[model samples]
Target chain A: MEQSSCTVVDAQETFSRAREQTLIESVKGGDTLAYHELYDAHVKRVYALCYRLTGDKALAEDATQEVFIQLWRKISNFTGQSRFSTWLHSVAANVTVSYMRKQRGWFQRMFSIDESEAQYHAAPADAHSIDLEALIVRLPERARMVFVLHAIEGYRHEDIASMLGMAVGSSKAQFHRARQLLKAWMGYDED
Target chain B: MTKTNFDDALKQQLDTLPEEKHPERDLWRGVALALENEADTSTAKPGWRSGWAAMAASVALIAMVSWYSLQQPSGPTEPSAITGEALVQALSQQHEQQKQALLVEYTDTPALADNWQQQLDELDDAAAAIKAALAEDPDNPALLRMLQNVYQQQITLIERVHAPKWQRI
Candidate 1:
């Protein structure tokens, strides 16, 4: 009975994937309803992704809008070599990271952590979410970015290295550094 | 396709990080308006593919600059394992890759100048000379600047040939 239930759940997931794939095809054809459906399904997740990367609600909101707009413009490039959500997440990450970079000053490009550490801490406190998300926002810029991309998004260090233009070792080091910093701040062992 | 499962202290809390975090305001309205705005631009200015050409040019330019900066920096530089030779090889490989892609893309596009290929060949020779000079004096700022100039010229050549400027009437 347990095995059969697992099989049924797997079947349901497969069905959902197929349905979403078909909807993506419709979206490729510039179907407005299909686009809306895709947005309805993916917006919150995309927004969350943007928020985690930017650590700013306003910036995340802007990045979310930009992601969808970019999706509409570049949907024709979706070659189906990867899953739609995977491709969409890639787009969202690229958009968010680039947006964050642009919003930085010339000095921030030279230094990973900005003076905004105080500002990031100054944001409103969320009572219910004192876990990873809160600590994530508290991380310095580079560590936060590496942590989000590696830990939260499950990107391999190799891919993160390429996207962020660093070596694979540095990417791994950043992830380690991020975990240690988070653990220190949270006063616990996460590793 | 990220596996959100964690196996540490925050495992339970991490599990609670929902896949979706709804925005405070409805954003579809802005998206719809943007779609309409883009639609207007498309119809108003036909064949905006040049915009992509422009963007590609910018990306390639940035990549070249980034490659240079990564080579000549201390903090946040490329991995320690990548030596100066590897840096040169990487930059050359990146240049060749982008150059080939540009050639393929602009194969049928009308050239702005009949002598553009000759100009590119000359720039390539200059870049080669600069590389040879840098090989002798790796830390020469003048040589590095010249190398970057050569690269910038190559990208400018590609962009000009593929996405020529519009002349005002």
Candidate 2:
């Protein structure tokens, strides 16, 4: 029974992967249904990537939608040189990075009002659910991206390097730095 | 802690993090419907737009190619524009001459008519094969390049034959 269950699970995963490949090929051939299918499959992962990068829900949501919009515009250029997930991640990474770079000038203005805004959105003090995720929000941009990819998404340094256009060594260094920072923030030294 | 231990710890932490969920399918469906409803009739939908754009782009690309071709000096109203058949004939002529040149190198005397006749017969067979291949794909750039290279080599061989060898001073 266990062996049969394992095979069933493996088959399901394989079927889904093949389905995604078909959807990508169809999208390249200009099929709208394929677009919808691809969008549905990836929107959350895209949103999570954006959210982790930006640490702002609204910005993440907008970036996620814009990423899909750009994907629709550029899907024809995708000649399947890389896995579809890798290509999509690269697009999202680039879009988020560009958006963050452009928004840096607004940081000073936002900093002034950040405290009041934080208080307004703050959940109850004893809330375990919110505080854990809230700790992630405080992480620096590069660290957050490293943590999201290396930690949350199970991507290797080499994969992250190709997706983010960083050197593999730099990706490892960033992952190390992100881990150290997160450990510090969470007060793990006492443990 | 050792590097391996640190990595193991990090992996555990990452795996333990909560998976994020987005708004429900119905909400996304509603958004999709709204976007579709607002679609500009002036600009056709995405798939059709890409197809139309691809066709337009191909035409423009071909036009650019023709424009560049025009920039090169075309001989004025010449009856001898380079065509596929002309090119095959040129290659046949070339292969024959090259075979003769190679044969002459062995024979010491350059003008052995019997050797030259055998080379010409081989060239005729080669030219027939080339003509058939070129007929299948006349516009293939790779074949065109190969044909051009053969023509240039033949010209050089002809020049070599015509040149006078130097006398000792």
Candidate 3:
């Protein structure tokens, strides 16, 4: 008899187990190569996060590298208390936001009164092509990061709170604010 | 434009992102090499023990290099400023120190060691470009600092990998 196809649940389980195990061993064997493999697997996703956070490709690229560079410099502290991906996103969010603060004028460049009004109506189809990715770039720094982690990347408000050094409710509120902004920009009603 | 309507539209958009964008494998290999160099030294552990040690080493390394650069007094005056991007890129090269722990954290697959020596050479080229840029504008403190950092990081990585007793593997 033919074997049944692997279910989504099974695949997820297999992948997670494999990933977790790989990390555990690499850490044990003193394999820096393993450390980078993990970084490589996730750099683009992290870059997408930074790009959305900064809305400037060059700045985002810097922030993206900083996130991994920080991770590489600090991965020895990754206690398996929480999921590795969760911790990684937390670092990505914080680093991007901090870098954005230093950048000084990103908000106005992307969302000034004139640009918002202009982009609102004729938002291109390609706008949503990188849905979570593109929607993120349009968000203000804090809200963009909150929404990226909670709504898109799927972290809980509590986890976001801890990672970002904010209150849990605030994390929830920011996520909502981000969604509202995205809706408004994308031609959605506030309610 | 309604809330529900927006959610539908946004959901549809979110679902459309391409599953993957194949990285320039060649470039990624270089990045991988750097990460390996960062993680190469140190014992692996569950949490911050190893990380803290690495951070301490990095800070010390940076400080030492900065001190050494300053001590040269005759090297260059009016250190040029570098773009923030270049500063971060320079820091990104110590891949040797952090790769091993990452391997343990993600254990199943073997970590691939790429052509790190080639990446180091690429870094020299990049550093030369940055230095040339700084030469044109020597008054920029930021660029000057970055040039110093890049120069030091490249020298250190080269020294570490090419040390008399060490092999690339």
Candidate 4:
């Protein structure tokens, strides 16, 4: 009975994967309906990533829209070497960072302005519902980005460094800074 | 909380973070509209050709303004005189009128980027800086050219962002 149940589960997984591949192929062939279906399946997760990365709802919405728009254009580039979700999340991260860079002034970008604390204080009342998330937003900008990308998004420190244009050491330092700040805010006793 | 306990608690909190978060607003309409516009722009050859033509015309206008400004007397002059200052004023007035018209025409159109106005303002600031430089060296062809390029960039940006749907089709 257990052996038969395992076989059934494996069959279901195969069927789901096949269906997703077909949907992706149709989207690549300029089928808007199929594209819409793909969007519906992935948008929530994409928005969640963008929201955490940006720490703002409106920016996240804009980033999510951009991600989908670019995804439609670049869907054909998916060689299927990795899972589609993984590829899409990578695309989302790159697009959100690029979008934010374009939105900032040259002076701000050059100086690497740390507005994370100010933004945290100004965070909407609704964001305070989650304790850790609120604290994450309060971290300094670089540290916050590193933490969200590493601790939350499961990216390697090297990947975070490349994405944010910082050294690997800087990425590690930022992550450490983020953890210390979060711990302090959470009232964790530090030795 | 002890360090070990804190680590565990933090890990738990991270684990509980939802994988999916629906946006407060339905974003499909905007995405669909942008995709449709992208398709239209790519398919419409005449519109693409006209975009290039418009850019060429702008370049020609800039040259004309620079030549005309060069013909006028250099150094401090009457406010109403047809010097570089007058040319700047004329260009600024024309740019403002065109911008306002574009804004009105695309009042309902969704902009592709949220910070386009801020970008335009930044370009305007660059233009102002060039104009200030021109004030010190009224006959400086380089300064005049730089100012013209900045203005051209502003016009291009505005048109690119708020381009009329009908025009593309």
Q: What digit string (tens of lDDT, one per residue) describes model 3 on residues B67-94? A: 4565554655543354445544444444
Rank all candidate structures by their DockQ, best first, as comma-separated numbers: 4, 1, 3, 2
Model 4 misplacement above 4 A: A1-9, A106-113, A118-130, B44-169
Our tally of clashes for model 2 stands at 0
For every candidate, give the share of true A-B contacts it also has: 0.45, 0.22, 0.25, 0.64
Best by TM-score: 4
Where is model 3 more than 4 Å wrong at Cα? A1-3, A7-16, A27-29, A81-83, A101-132, A155-177, A189-191, B15-169
lDDT of 2 at A50: 81
The candidate that wins on lDDT is 4
Residues B5-124 of candidate 2: C-alpha lDDT, one tens digit per residue: 545655565566555547332234433433344333425544433433343344335534644564466655323366566655665677667757764664554431222233333333
lDDT of 1 by residue, B1-169 (tens): 1123223545666667888898887777677567656655675331223333333344446545655665665665334445555656777788888888888998888764444576577677667866886686564454555666677768777776556432111
Q: Residue by residue across A105-135, what tens digits does model 4's lDDT show? A: 5248535666555433432333225477767
In CAPRI terms, model 4 is classed as acceptable
Model 1 CA deviation exceeding 4 Å by range: A1-15, A106-113, A116-129, A189-191, B1-7, B43-169
What's the lDDT for candidate 3? 0.58
**Tens digits of per-residue lDDT for model 4, B88-168:** 777678878987887787889876444467667766666776677677666566566767687777776777666533235
Point to the candidate with the largest DockQ. Answer: 4
- Fill in the DockQ of model 4: 0.24
- lDDT, candidate 1, at A149: 93
| C-alpha TM-score for every candidate | 0.56, 0.48, 0.48, 0.60
